[model samples]
Target chain A: EPEVTQTPSHQVTQMGQEVILRCVPISNHLYFYWYRQILGQKVEFLVSFYNNEISEKSEIFDDQFSVERPDGSNFTLKIRSTKLEDSAMYFCASRPPGLATFTGELFFGEGSRLTVL
Target chain B: EDQVTQSPEALRLQEGESSSLNCSYTVSGLRGLFWYRQDPGKGPEFLFTLYSAGEEKEKERLKATLTKKESFLHITAPKPEDSATYLCAVLVAGGGADGLTFGKGTHLIIQP
Candidate 1:
């Protein structure tokens, strides 16, 4: 089955450095999202995108965070000036546009582990 | 804010053991409740989605039930491969936020 794919399985960066995490959602999927999981914690929503624009975002998705679909097949999340607390496993997910059989499914990528030093 | 609480924090079961995991939730309005499985260092894998009260769905060795207030994931004759952290999330209706509010998750260990 086709699955979401993310790049840079793991990344380590200085506290003040910038980081960009990339993802390619399933070919037929239309809704894209970014979520993060701090070590041993819950998965928290960051943002959702559709129609090539941001649909919604959470408080955690502050000014430091930004997402873009720079190309037809790529979705990217950039973190400006990472902090120690920014370290976490960031996941990219997508779902096909709502249809008769839709029951709220979000397919996810393997995730990118970010470690801030 | 939407909230989801899963219990107990962890569970350990011997092979072929049957058990149930609980997911309690509070949302402004229910859109759907979702279940996912996560292995260490991996993103969550979607398992099931229950859209309304009294609805149920099943997969091999797994059955999920939903209610107005909570949901349950029952595992029958489970194998070690079934071991993983199970997460439950909620999507609120009319919230304009398609993002999910996830529970901390229940970590299950099935020993063969």
Candidate 2:
């Protein structure tokens, strides 16, 4: 089965440095999303993209965060400057649009673990 | 505000043992509920979707049931491979993009 894939399975960065997490969602999927899981915490939604634009974002997705689909298959999330709290596993997901009823079956990538020190 | 709460943060069962994990939530407008499994160091894999109250779905050894306020994931005669964190999430149609709100997961350990 085709699956979403992410690059840099693990990333380590300085507290004030920048980091960009990349993902390649399933080719045919139309909607893309980003979510994060802090160690020992629930996975939290960051943002969603469709039609090459941001559809929605959470409070955690503040000015420091940005997402881009620079190419047909790549979806990336960039954090201007990392913080200790930024340490977490970031996952990318995608899904087809317009199902008769919403089921919430978002396909996810393996995830990129980010460690900030 | 929407909130999701899962009970029994962790569970350990011997192989072939059966048990259920609970996921409860409060959403402004409940559109659907989802169940996922995540192994250590991997992303969540979709397992089942419950769209409304009284709906149920199953696959292999796993069965999911939903009610207005909560959902349950029952694992029957589970094997060691069935051990993983079971996550539950709810989608709110009238809310933000993707419309998802998740609860902390229930970590299940099946020992062979």
Specify the highest-lDDT model's number: 1
- After superposition on all C-alphas, the RMSD of every candidate to the true structure, in Å, is 1.3, 1.3
lDDT of 2: 0.92
Angstrom error of the Cα, residue B81, model 2: value is: 1.0
Tens-digit lDDT track of model 2 for B1-112: 8999998899999999999999999888887899999999899998998988999999999999999999999999999999899999988867445657888999999999
Off by over 4 Å in 1: A98-102
User: TM-score of chain B only, all predictions?
Assistant: 0.97, 0.95
lDDT of 1 by residue, B1-112 (tens): 6789999999999999999999999888988899999998788999999998999999999999998899999999999999999999998877476888899999999999
> How far in Å is the alpha carbon of A61 misplaced in model 1?
0.5
lDDT of 1 by residue, A1-117 (tens): 899999999999999999999999998888999999999899999999999999999999999999999999999999999999999999999999767544668899999999999
Q: What is candidate 2's TM-score for chain B alone?
A: 0.95
